[model samples]
Target: MKKFIKKIVLFLSPCFLILCLIVVADPFKVWFNYDDYNSAVTQNGEHVRFKLFNNNKDKYHFDSFIFGSSRSHAYKTQEWKKHLKDSASPFLFCASSEGIYGILNKLKYLDNLNNPIKNVLLVLDEHCMRGNSNKKGHLYISTPALSNESSLEFYKTFVVASLNV
Candidate 1:
């Protein structure tokens, strides 16, 4: 009986650890947060397209969006504001390895907003369509919601990925 219990504990250890990481890391920006995700862990926060949006979407009012891979990062919000001469701000949703999925998701998300999307600049490269599967895209900048998956499924996929790592 003791040996069986020991084996059970061993099997559960990794599961517990992964759960802790998910809660503490809070990549989805929905778990373990109180008043606000008002905070985040920087260890893996660099891939923050989702986090940045989640943490500040309600606060920032943007009429323009610059979407693409790393190339889009060069367009500062100020530059866009200056060029367009608009009162509404611009938000750049760029990452090192963004693809069609991420771009489409952000666009859809912006489209559903109450305010109108004034301008959109999408910069693409040969590698944008290099892959057929959305799951294979960059993990840091992707979200399940963009792919039409439910939030619960996203959490499940995240947990599974945690185990793989």
Candidate 2:
């Protein structure tokens, strides 16, 4: 019994040590900053998703909400703010390229809010509708309402972001 216990400890000790080393390295911790602030970490990886929307309700109430894969994140809020031209109407671009399932997850959580999201721009890459075997016909369906009205742009930013992620 003592020999068996010794073998188990010897096997697990290296793995445990490697895990400790990786945590101490903190590789992604420094890459979490944008807009001169480390808000991405504080927003996505740390705080609960719904909490973010709820906390900022006063600022985003009756505003336009942008949703999409990582493609949407590439848009600079300052540039979009000017495009919107309505200073009082605040907008947020909450985007992720984790696939359609990810976007749906975020939308489902945010949809619970009482805020009036006048426009939801679904900046999608072609892959958002195709190669999505992960969710089984879930996020690929066409919305006729948005199809006729939404502006379609093939931005280079989304491609770069997709590669980075």
Candidate 3:
């Protein structure tokens, strides 16, 4: 029993150290000022991520949303809104090397918003999908109502990824 315990500890030690490193690196700290802050919040704690989510129904609401990895960061929300000639929300929930699973996870958050989303623009980054073939582009499909399948699948993937790291 002691030997078995020791082996388990040895195997998990490196993983624990890596997790500590990541937390100390503070990836989210620097990103707070990036697109994440802009899209998710306004001057105060007011949520500005979606123009049509709740308060500003009388005015124009965001009919479209952008979904993609960090490479998609190059596309600015104001520029996209101008180009499309429509109110569209730009999401920056993606990270480097993120795959379809990441995109799906982000959509799950939108699916829980108070207001409904009408359209979504998913950016396809070539490098992320290079070796992935079984990609089902339905990761970003969402409904206003919370989906049990989507929630469970997303949480499952998140837990697995977090631990596997």
Candidate 4:
């Protein structure tokens, strides 16, 4: 029995060490607060944008938003503000590869926050309009906060992904 236990420990030790490294290193920036993320690793821009908005929403008090995939980046906030009331504080709520579900969830999240959504500009392409489900992969998954997904599962997905490479 003691020999069997030793073998079990030996087998698990590497996995335990890898998990520890995942927690400490946090290559995906999921476990720590960061000023900026590594650009080389494609991150979930949706999660990053949501974190930024959630953290600074009170300070900025954004009332207007531009929502879409990377294409939305073309619409400058300053330029969009020109069309809205002077009191409008516009924010860009874009994702790397946004889908319709992502856009709806973001809107729902803001509504839940009781945020005054004064104006919205939605830039959509064929793909954005067609997609009806949350994307998979670490770089495309919607943020758990907005998607109402289990936080554990979200982190686990990243941890598993990190292990793959």
Candidate 5:
């Protein structure tokens, strides 16, 4: 029995060590606080944008938003702001591959937060209308705060993704 238990421990030790490393290293940046997120690794733009808005909302007092997918990046915030009222504080709230579901959820999130939504520029195309569901993969997944998903499940998704390759 002692020998059998020793073998089991040896077999499981590497798995335990890997998990520990995953928690400590946080290759996906999901487990730790970061000042500037590294752009080399394709991150979930939805999550990153949401976190950025939440962190600086009070200071910026952003009341206007431009929501869309990567294509919308061409719409400069300065140009968009020119169309809005003088008091509008505009923010670019875009995602990597945004769909209608993401856009609606982001709108709902802002409404729930009691933030004023004075102006909105939605740069939409056929792609944005094609999907109304949450995207898969760590880089495309919706943020928990926007999707109302379990935070544990969100973190688990990132952890599992980091282990896949």
Candidate 6:
């Protein structure tokens, strides 16, 4: 039994170590405390699917935003730019199964960016209104840190989701 326990520990220790390392390193910048990360930690590794608008808000000087689920992906940004004939470049912030709460969270993050939001294209679906707003067990990938909620439940959700990732 002693030998068996030792072998199991030896095998599992490395995996535990790697898990901790991932939590700290956070390559995708989706989970963990990014505040500890310095400029040396590459911001370019962010998962762009749901985070594009938040990650690159300053890069495009975007005045317009498109927020919705995966269905909204078909609406090309350039098409809207041509239709509006405005200087504001469109940024599509969409993800699979994105709901109303997720869209609201994105808008909140955009507002926090402190840039003027002149135009918004919101493509929504029927499911958005039926469920609880804000979150549904890591269904969407947007950062909870953006919400500025510091309660245990908030931390629990993020940490649990991060650990799952």
Candidate with top lDDT is 4
TM-score of every candidate relative to the true structure: 0.67, 0.50, 0.40, 0.87, 0.85, 0.63
Which pairs in model 1 have colliding backbones? none
On a 0 to 100 scale, what is the lDDT of residue 143 in model 4?
Answer: 74
Q: Tens digits of per-residue lDDT for model 1 on 1-165?
A: 999999999999998887998768665454433344333432222135555665566787667778887777777878778888557667777755667766777777767766568888787888767523454312443455555665575566556555554
RMSD to true structure for each model, in Å = 4.7, 11.1, 9.7, 2.0, 2.4, 7.4
Cα lDDT of model 5 by residue, 98-137, tens digit: 9999999999989998999988899999889975887878
Backbone clashes per model, in order? 0, 3, 0, 0, 0, 0
Best by TM-score: 4
lDDT of 1: 0.63
Model 6 Cα lDDT, one tens digit per residue, 40-95: 43232112443555556568787887877777878999988887756778888675
How well is each residue in 105-128 modelled by candidate 2, as lDDT tens digits? 555554554555555656778766
Pairwise TM-score winner, candidates 4 and 5: 4
Q: lDDT, candidate 6, residue 91?
A: 80
Residue clash pairs of candidate 2:
69-96, 70-96, 70-97
lDDT of 4 by residue, 120-148 (tens): 99999988976687788887888788888
Model 2 ranges off by over 4 Å: 30-63, 83-98, 112-116, 131-165
lDDT per residue for candidate 3 within 1-165, as digits (tens), equals: 999999999999998896666445433222123334432211211112222233343454445666665566677667766766444654333444445655554466556554456566677867656523223222222211222345444333433344443
Ranking by TM-score: 4, 5, 1, 6, 2, 3
The models' CA-based lDDT, in order, is 0.63, 0.44, 0.45, 0.87, 0.85, 0.62
Query: Regarding lDDT, does 2 or 4 come out ahead?
Result: 4
Task: Indicate the residue-level lDDT of 99 in model 3.
Answer: 57
